[model samples]
Target: MTSHQPPLWRRAVAELLGTGLLVSIVVGSGIAAQQLSPNDVGLQLLQNSTATVLGLTVLILMLGPVSGAHLNPVISLVDWALGRRSGTGLTLPDLGTYVVAQTVGAIGGSVLANAMFEVGTSISVKDRATTGHLLGEVVATAGLVLLIFALAATKRGVLAAPAVGAYIGAAYWFTSSTSFANPAVTVGRIFSDTFAGIAPVSVPAFVVAQLLGAAVGLGLLLILFPSAARNTGDIVLPHSAEKTSA
Candidate 1:
């Protein structure tokens, strides 16, 4: 190994590349659902949701070993705030790097989706979210980020693929934003004209809602597992950190 650690830039680049890949899968799958549907929107939604879970599952399993598959900025920020990461570190600058990478990656992913699907603005924003919908989104995303924190923060229980996959699959239908805690993913969907795509104007609200959700999730997790506070050794390092070190 080199004497010096891989600079923060490489780690940041990995995050950007990984987020871009995830958005491509998410947006592309949404487009596929629309193209295959005739009038059965329920079936279309099922297809869209299924595609999302499968894509995310594989991405997590694959990238989880590398980037921690964070893809979601909220997840990264919360982890850093929790003081879980160690020798390698998760600094504010690191948080900035991750978010920037993920955002730029999301933009690239959205552009790719547009180029592939030829969607200009088939599905655009409607209006400011209603109080109920906003609340629902907040609750949903909070649960999502909490789940990430719970899975990463603790070490006693194993986070097998089936358990995590099922949880994500279930979360999608339950949330107003369909449990999209990833700001990058949320922003990228604006480029698509599919049922799964969000309107550009509506994206900011979703981001705010998710940030709130993450806070809620973190609170609940801490409350439920007070004992876990002592142990955060494993959760800190990005899944890829080990690889880069090796």
Candidate 2:
């Protein structure tokens, strides 16, 4: 593939489309699990979460070559913090464009779920979203973002993409929120009226928690992988930050 400086329009569109696709697969799977095994919620969550990880991993692998497929605002922020973000740090234009694309994409994905499952907001908020649950969301999302940056954004992780997928799969099990790591995914879940709906009032807490968790995860990653964490990619894309500047 060629190194790209995408037309602004195309990149923005890609961000939206990618987010939409992620939600459709994720929320769609959650609905499927519920309907297929209504009585066994534990099993349902496990199956749905597994499908989600695979879906996201596959989506990233497929779309990443085209767009870098950051897929989450927190992931982008962590990359910027780590010095791997394009333009060397997060620029307002880049951040704004990405956030808008992700938000729009989330809505698009939710709409698709609405159509496919015949789901409507008519189903009231069963998941009022407690503070503890939101706490779980923060921890789960942060770990996911940190993993993405450490493994994919950093130079060492560029070569360990498959491991990134493995770690995510496990995170879904270990984390209390079943690892709804992507902010785009979190945003899209609001559209679902099933077990995943997060009340609008509680969204601020979730977002704050996600941001904080990502920070902690990054700190842990730096401590654990000191040498690799030091990598600062002179490269923008298609090359690890660790690549020699020859």
Candidate 3:
């Protein structure tokens, strides 16, 4: 938002490209894992989570300079919501563009992943919206939001890349739904009928759960660190104009 920062268009493209690649990594690795370890579900998850962890960390480090790397809708939404009072973080207009870019990037990434794997893009038939899965989404997303903002609030934004990636990797194993905590990623996964895909029918509930989780995360942040909202602009990582140029 400063003179030295990248323009909105450039930042939006960064978000689109970063989010696309992230989903590609997710879907591609899932397909590879399925083929590599055909019978062992645990092995498949291991491969998928490992790739996701590395890929996401790289994406955040690579793109955080441009867009603050708010790759998730809830992240953007929460940023806007929390910063409204402080007049910081993403503006309403920017939030809208970010979400659109993310959603488009997510779908494109899924399709690209299917193409890379030589699999036809089709709606996923994996029904994952069970009560346990929904509950897992809530926990996973709440934890994600809490982690990101907590880092920013504590001036540990430098650790966001690895910390967020590690939390997600752990959540993949602990959460029943494998922590598809992102709404855009969830929607994108609906296009690929792969091991990492989710049923289209489940996307609505998943998105709702994620939104609710964001609220819970914000509530927790306020309770534990009442001053957290003041640093909402730093969510995810520090992408100040000066740092970005450096």
Over 4 Å off in model 2, which ranges? 1-4, 84-90, 121-124, 153-161, 225-246
Which model scores highest in lDDT? 3
Error of 2 at 123 (Å): 7.0
Write the residue-wise lDDT of candidate 1 on 108-156 in tens digits.
8777876777777454554436666677768876776666656655662
Tell me the TM-score of each prediction against the true structure.
Answer: 0.83, 0.81, 0.96
Q: How do all the candidates rank in terms of lDDT, highest first?
A: 3, 1, 2
lDDT of 2: 0.65
Against the hidden true structure, what lDDT does model 1 obtain? Answer: 0.67
Error of 1 at 58 (Å): 1.3
Report the lDDT of model 1 for residue 74. Answer: 85
State candidate 1's TM-score.
Answer: 0.83
Clashes in each model (backbone N, CA, C under 3 Å)? Answer: 2, 2, 0
Candidate 3 versus the native: TM-score? 0.96
lDDT of 3 by residue, 133-237 (tens): 999999999999999998888889889999999999999999999998899999999999999999988999999999999899989988888778789767677
